[model samples]
Target: MTDKSKKVTENSDFIITLNSLTRFVLGAVGGYNMQTKLKGVREMNDGSIFNSSHTLEIEKDLLLFFNTWVDIQGDKFSNDRKGFQLVTTLIQALGLVFHHIWHCCSNMSKTERTHQIYIAAKKLAQINYSRDAEHWKNCSFLTLNEDDLNYKVNSGGSTTRKHFARYLCSKIGFNY
Candidate 1:
């Protein structure tokens, strides 16, 4: 079968690449409604957060659809600006999606496995590790072998905002 026909497997590197591309794409559409909604989140003095769950659901759907569309197109647009833009949009959507997913995981009670996944996703987001670094720092952890959950917590913030995206896929079954 052609590579395009085969399913894309889940992996940290791919997700990170997608996230970076997404962030770049967001730059092109800075005033987008979704972007505005994400940036408009408000926290009140009484500790109540005012945000739209409807918007979050829209973001989630967009992310899923964009990623799936990319998979459907495969490498056909790989060598052009459209390809770059598409990838960027897909990645940026991924970062937003995961950002929200982490929040959802945080607010809900979960199974031990899911909770552990959430913790890793949190640390991964905190460290801002590149996918390679994320792989080095937490691949094993992601696989359930770590004794210390806070391992990536103390790392520098120079890491890219890609780990949560990766974690969403590898740990939480976010198929592209």
Candidate 2:
């Protein structure tokens, strides 16, 4: 294989390794229970403290994963294309995960989790818009269009501002 391809493969392997380690750590730290609670929120509108606890646990895991990845790859990348691609992929994964968490939280009965989700979403949107308004200028991934906005207003949770922020964070590599 070519040198660049080899490098990409190596980087990808490293990322996979890191992902596995993070999952392991999360599992050890009661991530499974958190995941179950998140699933429960999605399946049922039960707004319990379990949901809040799960959200907090997942959030902590996300922060740790990002910090660890950055620490390992920060100096090694140095503007390299492969490194940039890796970082971007990681960010996208993070945003997607956060969006899913938000969705789960939103599913809960109007309670603290729901409120937290709304607040988090708003924060994410603000951060994205502030960092680069242009990134969302022409994007239509999540009902950014006028029609979509009107539709969402009519149907709640169809498209959330928080999910949009998560997407922007993923795209722009915002260290949230």
Candidate 3:
């Protein structure tokens, strides 16, 4: 049987690359809607608190999508009601980041997607790490990369913004 005509036996074979799957999910015209949603997420007191159920739904979706790949054990913080709340809050923060990424390149052509992702990466880096424009522009995006969920959080389950930012960026294929 020819490679092109062979029937796939595994579900994993259906997805050749994460970017391709992401591209399919973020279809043409998805950017505008994502942008509007991002504005809403941003307006929700920086996604630390979710008031709308619609936003909550999207946040849940984001968590499912993300955790399906790399399980972010919120229990890493602690094991109790407070840990549960911590997990939910962390999911909300990451959902905002996912929305921001989709909003950046969802409507762009393949040729322009890298540039858009780069811009998004730079902006994210600025938000979480450095404010210097030239520094990020010249630095490697991989510099932001780290282990999936093992980050330095204080006793209260709080961490720097860069931790989540880098994980999402790395998983989303931000390499330079």
Candidate 4:
């Protein structure tokens, strides 16, 4: 076979295997197939107990696998649109799934957190995200200027909203 045809076959096979694995993992955790999706405290069609701890552990393992796979194979798929999409979608979906699980398990949901940040942000005039989230998280910056304060990098996802809000506050000489 030509190199391109061989690569296409490999990519197709990988996609099929990944989809099957995702369905199996979801089913094992919730006792229902992915088609009939369910999350925390939601009723499964089969009425089986959803073992959340087990699910988290399994999901953690999958997360690690995906992280490592991306680290190793991300470049191989970069030039191939289908392969890149498959890899990225798998990683993004798994990240979102884990985030949802974390939100369900946490006392504070992302929305609540964002609201709290919004209230804090109201005190300051800054509305847009304009600082590195790590500054707020660490809360130990030797010196910060107005220009340095309101810059956003790597700011997306539920967890970062609060961080972004805090960053915004920091830009206006507010410590959050």
| Each candidate: RMSD | 16.7, 16.4, 15.8, 15.4
Native-referenced Cα lDDT, model 2: 0.38
Q: Can you tell me which runs of candidate 4 are displaced by over 4 Å?
A: 1-32, 38-46, 49-54, 84-176
Global local distance difference test of model 4 = 0.38
Candidate 2 lDDT, 1-176, residue by residue in tens: 12223123433434334433333333323323332222223322343443245546456535544454445444443334332223323334334445455455555664565455444444443332221234544445423336433211112221332344345445544432
Residue runs of model 1 more than 4 Å from their true location after superposition: 1-52, 56-60, 75-176
Worst 10 residues of 3 by lDDT: 23-32
lDDT, model 3, position 91: 35
Residues 94-150, model 1: lDDT tens digits? 444444544445555545435544444343333322222344454432232266332
Q: By TM-score, who's the top model here?
A: 3
- Report lDDT (Cα) of residue 59, candidate 3: 42
Where in model 3 is the C-alpha error above 4 Å? 1-89, 108-151, 154-159
Write down the RMSD of candidate 3 (Cα, Å).
15.8
59-120 per-residue lDDT for model 3 (tens digits)? 44443445432333333322332221133223333444555664555577644654554444
> Which residue window of length 10 is worst by lDDT in model 2?
149-158
Q: What is the TM-score of candidate 3?
A: 0.28
Please report the TM-score between candidate 2 and the true structure: 0.24
Question: What are the lDDT figures for the candidates, one per model?
Answer: 0.37, 0.38, 0.35, 0.38
lDDT of 4 by residue, 1-176 (tens): 12222122333534334443443355334432331343455454456555565566445444443344344444543434333123222333333333333333346665554444333323322221123433333433212435856322243333342333244335544443
Better of 2 and 4 by TM-score: 4
- lDDT-wise, the better of 3 and 4 is 4
